[model samples]
Target: MTNEELKKAALDYHEFPRPGKLGIEITKGFSTPEELSLAYTPGVAEPVLAIQANPEDAYRYTAKGNLVAVISNGTAVLGLGDCGALAGKPVMEGKAVLFKKFADIDVFDIEVDAKEPKDFIDTVARIAPTFGGINLEDIAAPSCFEIEDALIERLDIPVFHDDQHGTAIVLCAGLINALELVGKKIEDVRIVCLGAGAAGIASMRLAVDLGARRENMLLVDRKGVIHRDRDDFSKLNKEKLEFASAASAERRSLAGALAGADVFIGVSGPGLMKPEWLMLMAENPLIFALSNPVPEILPEAAWSVRKDLIMATGRSDYPNQVNNVLCFPFIFRGALDVRARTINSAMKVAAVKAIAELAKQPVPQEVLAAYRKNSLSFGPDYIIPKPIDPRLRDIVAPAVARAAVDSGAARLPYPAHYPV
Candidate 1:
């Protein structure tokens, strides 16, 4: 479809469906007067009193255990930039659709009308009890870090920012398999990230957890490669400080940074990564140009320069797409299944491993049918699993739940229904 056609279709999709994408459906019968009375008065009071006496009963007697809050201040609404809270509701509701359709989980998309970090934090903290977990969305950098840290410390339930960690999880998963194909070890690869926003910082940190060398990774921004010797280095935020302090002081420019590097990850905008830069990287390099709708450099242009590299973009039309939907729904699924107190590092690492391993296994006939392919296997072009694969729920979530239990992040045991 053309861009104009897609615009109209998206608008119609949200507008025609009762003006919104969500509604409350009664899960129990109320056809009879007796059923109605039980649904409201006497039946409801028993569970209310029980929950009052023991707060844990809320999970058993109510939807709190399965419900997640998609909270956002709309400071950063996808590739569109800061678009305000009400403007971002459609996106949040779309998020709700993904959660339900993908993982069979429920959600409440809350667009908070607070711009300041403290006000947004206060509002979410006050209303935190209503949901089992919180999925922070679209809030801008530095403040997103603050809001998440405060809420994670204050709330006992799992709190996650999908834009940051979700992007990282999927990126690392594809990167893991890409490294294996090239016969390079994670700990030994020289990496360069072109964006230092929420997604970029979080990705590099997770890469470190997965055995990438901290001292070897380089973080770059608009001014150029982030280094202490630069004039604006002292103005860097805390997250940037962590990277800047340990950033390899080898090269100061983008061209210089890519020379001899094994990986070039661009979370930045279009046409920023010149086609000539691909030749500067080491043999068998990996490129993840993840700008949405448009990438740093088109795959065709990059391939013309370097045939030995594997490339991933955010577009579904491309092979090895880096999509967050591959992990977020299942991450919350596992956390909710285990009644996890928090989604910890071990759980995330487990999720990344599970996602990476899934691509190497035999592709289900159903998956191939959906993608219009007779055969698909793990290789340079197919390092990430498709988002619609049914095995994701069975594979990724169970591994995460196991990690939660093992890491003492869970409040309950792994479910009996889960795969052993």
Candidate 2:
């Protein structure tokens, strides 16, 4: 569709149905006065008292177990940066729709107009009790780090900043399969991650957890490659500093950094990854140019340079799309089901493995029908599972839940409702 036509359609979609994308739907009936009394006044008091006596009873009596809060400050709204919190409501509501549709989790899209990290942290901690999990969205970088860290420390619920770990998990999932296809080990491969924002830093860190060596990673931002000799460690955020590479003088620039690199991950903007740089990458290299609408380098351009490349993007049109939707909904599903306190590295790794492994299995007929494809095989192009696959809920969720339980992050046992 043309840009204008697409804009009109999107606006119409949000307007014609109602004022917004979300609405409150009562799960229980209360049509009669008797039902109303049972739903609210007298009967509600019993559950309230029970929950007051035993805090754990809130999970049994209320929707807290199934509810997640999609909170945002809109400071770092993707595709449109620094839009205010009020402007970010639509995006937050869209997230809620994904949560409910994908994993049967309810959500309240919260747009907080806090000016600083302290205010946002205070607000979220105060409202923490209302949710089983908190999905932080679209907040700007260093402050996002601060807010998420403080809230996770304060709240006993599963708190995740989707822009960071969600992208990281799915990226790792695809990366795992991509490396397997190329017959290379993650630990031995060199990876150059462009854009040292939340997604870049998080993906690189998670890659390290999955066996990628810290010394093998070259993180680049707008200025240049984040080398150890840059003398800017004090200026870098704690998250970004973890990735500073103590590389030789030749690796100080983006071009030099991509020299024989096995993986080139671009969370930066469009066209920043020159086609020439692709030639410098190792044989059978992987490229994740994940900027939305336009990637770091277009696939057509990259393909012209090298046919031995496995490329991924954030667009739906691409074969291996690194999407956050594939991670957050089901991760929360598993975390909530098992009453996990935090979404730790083990659970994230389980999600990565589950997503990667799912792509290897023969495509189910239902999934094939959804994609309008006869088959999807485990290969360079089809590395990550499609976000629409119903199996992700059953497969990824149980994997994460199992990991949570095994790693002592879960308060409850492995849920019987989930598949064995």
Clashes (backbone N, CA, C under 3 Å), per candidate, total 0, 1
Best by lDDT: 1
Q: Give the per-residue lDDT of model 2 (tens digit) for 1-420.
A: 999999999999999967888888888987999999989998899999999999999999999999999999999888799999999999999999999999999999999998599999999999999999999999998888888889989999999999999999999999999999999999999999999988998999899999999989989998788866776767877787788878898888999999999999999898999999899889998999999889999999999999999999999887898889999999999999999999999999999999999999988889889878988899988999998988899899999999999999999999888777
Question: Candidate 2 has what TM-score?
Answer: 0.98
Residue range 1-420, candidate 1, lDDT tens digits: 999999999889888957989887889889998998888987789999999999999999999999999999888998999899999999999999999999999999999999999999999999999999999999999899999999999999999999999999999999999999999999999999999999999999999999998788998899888888888877889998777844345588899899999999999899899999899999999999999889999999999999999999999998999999999999999999999989889999999999999999999999999999999999999999998999999999999999999999999998999988
Worst-scoring 10-residue span by lDDT in model 2: 227-236
CA lDDT, every prediction?
A: 0.93, 0.92
Q: After superposition, how far is residue 95 of candidate 2 from its true place, in Å?
A: 0.4
Residue clash pairs of candidate 2: 271-296
What does the lDDT come to for candidate 2? 0.92
Query: In model 2, which regions exceed 4 Å deviation?
Result: none
Candidate 1 wrongly placed segments (more than 4 Å) = 245-250
